[model samples]
Target: MLAYRHLFHAGNFADVFKHALLTRLLIALGKKDKPFFYLDTHAGIGRYDLNHEWAQKLAEHRDGIARLWERTDIPGPLEPYMACVRAENAGGRLRWYPGSPRIARAFLRPGDRAELTELNRDDANALGKLFDGDRQVHVHLMDGYQALKAFLPPKERRGLVLIDSSFDRAREFARLTDALATAHRRWASGVYALWYPLMDGTAMHAFERGVVATGIRRILKLELSVLPEGWNESLRGCGLLLVNPPYGLEDEARKMLPWLWRTLSEERTGGTEVRWVVPE
Candidate 1:
């Protein structure tokens, strides 16, 4: 959706969570000599300009990454995530933010392929133009979910799929559930990450319970943000459901969350929880 250009939100709290996890997972995927597929559904412009109107208004990063960036004294768990953000900034003045494609590009090694998809025409065109001369990445204008289904079990047999939808459609949650179920059925052993806002606690709980009921094992949840005290309040956090997360992520979350809670949250204090939804 053009309404959500990502330029305005880049390096904000949500991006901090999503990109940090993404960078870490891709890093883990690089461990093996075998090649892997990195799929980004709902990829936005490959990169963003903080000077843009949207970004300049709130400059939300001032409260998010801006707080963490200045400090070299990061906790161990967040070291990898912090490093990812820093490298993307190139120790520069954090004027730009790297989207999924740019973040994926940063870690791509020889033989590793990245497939980025954006349904929005404007964004798709921008994505294409963003890396017009690059050969390692493929920008697809296709529906990301369908494209993901078609590209399952990539030739390399190891892959990661990132589904970060805008959830503009009422049926988006259902569609996401069905799509993830289908993708999981297609590549049971692959790593899958799904992001969703904290729209409604009851609704989200029901959704998660249903997914776990499907018998997908090792479903780990990484949640950040504190619940508002009043019964009625805007959803303040986002979550990542990792279907086949790499080893050490749970441990990493354990150590990383406290520092993030202290730094990124606007409440001065917040909540961060990482645990298995389904027992190992």
Candidate 2:
């Protein structure tokens, strides 16, 4: 059934990797002023209060973002990522944590439009209010995976789509892998970012193979493991699979991964890799 609350782990390691990519993507889409569109599938509760009982219970952020909070001059490639976190965590301490939807909304401007979809009714309603007064952003209470099929090649014809889900339900992968084939077919030039876990690196390979089989021509995969290769013998790592990723992002990941691995290493074999099956 795949039912999990993001509040428990808002700014954990996953957010670090996912948002790092998203920050770079928004920067790319922001390069031009053609009114690019931003779409977020699987939007969670726009804002998160780490102090909340749910969030405080785990306090994973203490180890994740907190570990990298200070330390200025972060890496060249990681600057944007750090910038976004700092912007979100402004106001002295980390009181509120913005999820994908909230972070996407921050980039929206007068002409820019943001479309967010959340399958969970409670989350959808909350997501809507997150941007209630903002006419530039629209929130839909529906399945993000389904939205992939409905909203593509947005009106502007130039934009970024973020597919970020907890994958609480394994079916999400099935739907996401299929939707990529369909969405890319409709808007092959559109930029799409797919966030995934690395518990089982092998399974992720299969998913990427399926995506490559679609022959999208341009796809990049970035994987990061908190534990070393032999650290957790029974556990798998985590990674993000990107479609139509911006130019030079793979190299960016290449540098940022090592820094992250060093800071969050749980095993001796833990490391990072940035590679693409298609030409950039």
Candidate 3:
């Protein structure tokens, strides 16, 4: 849905989960001396002002990044992520938040390149202006799935693709599965990180089955829910499905998810999962 604006939920628990893991993925890619490409499909406005009326409406960040904002006990795996968040709020006041595009740009070495896509005209235009003069970054006003066909198999042969779609439309899960299957076939070696909301059990099972049917291997499934399963709420939790995940990601997630759940869970009811949907 083009009407979906990420600012309303920026810095929420889901953002914490996705952005933290996203930082780890970028870090893993940077481990290699060789330059890597980063494709951010569904890139929102690169930066969000937490004090903006939209963000203040829900004050969601209070439960997400705000909880960890002044903390000194964050695990080692989370340092890079925290550093980025802190960079956005230099005055010690949580005034701004960096979306994936800004976060990805933070880790870009001299040779590294980043491509961000957003379907919303306003967001796409904002994203373009955010990185306007930087030759290393490219912003496109296009559908994320279409971006896969257009930019996959990056010339560098090394990169990570983040598919974060607003699940407001019906059958989005099916569309993501099909598009991913096609993209994987096009560039099987590329690292892909997909974010989705945790839905009903039956729908979740069907989503899993669809991905399984793609016969994609080495899929790492990570999920964190603030509420217990079947919780009747707006959003129980969210998950990140990684394909061809870098080697230490699973272990890193084990540490990060539990800590995030401990800090962000209002009722302390929901849990975390770190497992292989399809092992190598």
Candidate 4:
């Protein structure tokens, strides 16, 4: 299960969908003066080199971040996320891409704190080195699901928890639902963002029902699929379920996701979705 390496898929459309929304959540947290905590479950290396052999094999970024790297019509809400990406590729070349940990770190105020967990030893080491001597960020070499139990109800009590599981194992959707319920029971008020790929209709519907069955309110579901329906060659889409999402996030997604779909989707067959899976 520890074999899931995000480097190969870094900056893909899924990352674009997840991280763009992630920045909004972080920005919403920063709007308050109180310091917040950020816990990244399944945190990979803080940054990725797209030119690496692993990444070059797929060259997925060409279809993802590369599409937006030099766009003249970048949406207003996406500026912060793009700013973080631009900061990493300061040489004006699209050589590097920031993962969720690095993206989250960019928005962390001096008073805020972040805890990142990675099960892969090598990735953990790299992640550790990425934030070495940074007093505000903490990296742990542990299973992300376990980190949820260990770090819930953070001392700050006001923050975001990102559950970006790799879904390499079977029954992962079930595990995510159960974990979200348990975490919500422990920290009902905390913001939670869970990311997942767009699988077949049967699995997707089942996952939706499982989450709704949890009875957690204020759940916002956002999805983007660049490929048309019935095209199952590869991962053509992804979604994020936000529990207790920050105010206006739904509205922001309503505006932002469509633009993303339009810009990223070449076929424009599959589109975007922004709705409440469970209301407050």
Candidate 5:
């Protein structure tokens, strides 16, 4: 599990989908006057240099952020996400990409807070250094699941939690389902976002069933696939399960994901879906 470095896939299609949606979540929180906390489990190095050897090896950004870097027709909701990327790479060249922590930090207001947890030593240390002088942010070098238990029901009592785990370990789907259900029980009001890669049909079905059985309502499921289900490529697509999602998130995603699929999909064989797994 430690072998999986997000730097290798920093600006890949999946990151585009996840980060775009993340921006919306934070924006929604800001709509309310009350302060909110943002938690990033599996927080990678706060930022990524796409020119780095690992990132350049695959040049995933060429298929991800590079597609949107200079686009003038970006949908309204995606403007914020692209702005974050542009901010990272000044001088009109795509050289850097912001991870979840960095994107969340951009939207943090005077009273807003953020917590980032990463089990990987190097990534944790980098994240620590990235937010060293910031008082509104805290970085924890610990297991994301453990951090969930320790930080739930945040004193603010309102915020978003993103569980963007690296699914390098076996049975990660089941583990995520259990953790989500437990977290919902502890803080039903908190917004929870869980990211997972699209994989085997049987496993995905079981994972869906587990979430349904949790008795948690208002769950929204959003997926974007850049390749056919039969494609044997590394990652055909990915999805995010949002528990207690904001009111306008589905509308925003509907407008945003299709454009992403069109821009990032190679063969145009993939698609997007935004629906409620459990309605309010």
Candidate 6:
């Protein structure tokens, strides 16, 4: 998994779906006066240049952010997310893409703090340089799952943890579920967002059952598929599981995901889904 680099897939449809929801979570955390902490496990380079060779290889952004770059009818709930993307591309050219760390840092208040961990030394070094002089953001070169055990129950006692793993290893789904259970026990009140690709039905169901077995409540599951059933050429969809989601996010997702599916789906074949995997 160490060789897995996100640059090849930066700004893809999955990125769009994940980051759009991420911005909403960060916004909700900021509504209260108290400062909160943010932990990004598997943080890639803080930002990406779409023109880079690695990014240009797949040119995934063409079907992702590029589709929304000039659109005027973007839904209101997505404005904050689009603004973050726009900020990375000045002069009206969509050449840059902000990764989760950059997007999260944008929402961090003066008093808020963030900790980003990346196992890849090169990626962690790049991430560290991205926030070199910033006192509020810290970068760590460590395994993301281990980071949960190290940084859980953050001092602020209020924040969000984004576990956006690469899913490059075997048994990653089980690993995510176990890590979630552990982290929840340590910080039950903290908001946790776990992202995963839509694999075969059996694996997906097993993952859902695993999470349910954890007995964690209030978990929201949002998924978007741009390819129709039976289309398996590549990753057709991805899902985000939100633990302790902020109020109204379920409704916001109901509104936001369908619009995304409409705009991003291929031949209008696939669709969106927003539902609670576990209720309070």
lDDT of 5 by residue, 1-280 (tens): 3989999998999999999999999999999999998888889998999889999998888888888887899999999999999898788888889999999999999999999999999999999999999999999999999888999979999999999999999989999999998888889999999999998788788989999999999999999999898777679999999999998999999999999999999889879999899898
Instruction: Give the distance in Å from residue 59's predicted Cα in candidate 2 to where it truly belongs.
Output: 1.7
lDDT of each: 0.80, 0.78, 0.93, 0.93, 0.92, 0.95
Q: List model 2 lDDT by residue over 1-280, tens digit each.
A: 2377888888887788788778778877887888889889888988888899999998878767777787665888777667666776678687677788777766776899988988878878888877888888899987887787788878899899888877776566677788888888888888888887665556666777777777787777787777655444523356777777777676777778888877666554566778776765
lDDT score, candidate 3, position 220: 92
Q: For residues 114-144, could you state the per-residue lDDT of candidate 6 as single tens digits?
A: 9999999999999999999999999999999
Writing each residue's lDDT as its tens digit, candidate 4 over 1-280 gives 4777899999988899899999999999999999999999989999999999999989889889999999978999999999999999989998999999999999999999999999999999999999999999999999899998999989998999999999999999999999999999999999999999899899999999999999899998999999977779988899999999998898999989999998889677789998889988
Q: What is the lDDT of residue 92 in candidate 5?
A: 80
Model 1 segments more than 4 A misplaced: 88-91, 226-235
Candidate 5 TM-score over all chains jointly: 0.98
Error of 5 at 12 (Å): 0.7
Clashing pairs in 4: none
TM-score of each: 0.92, 0.91, 0.98, 0.98, 0.98, 0.99
lDDT of 5 at 83: 93
Better of 4 and 6 by lDDT: 6
Off by over 4 Å in 2: 229-236, 267-269
Superior candidate under TM-score, 2 versus 5: 5
Model 2 residue 65 CA deviation (Å) reads 0.7
lDDT by residue (1-280, candidate 3, tens digit) is: 4778989999999999999999999999999999999999899998999999999998888988999998989999999999999998889888999999999999999999999999999999999999999999999999999999999889999999999998989999999999899999999999999999999999999999999999999999999999888887567899999999999999999988999999999779889999899999
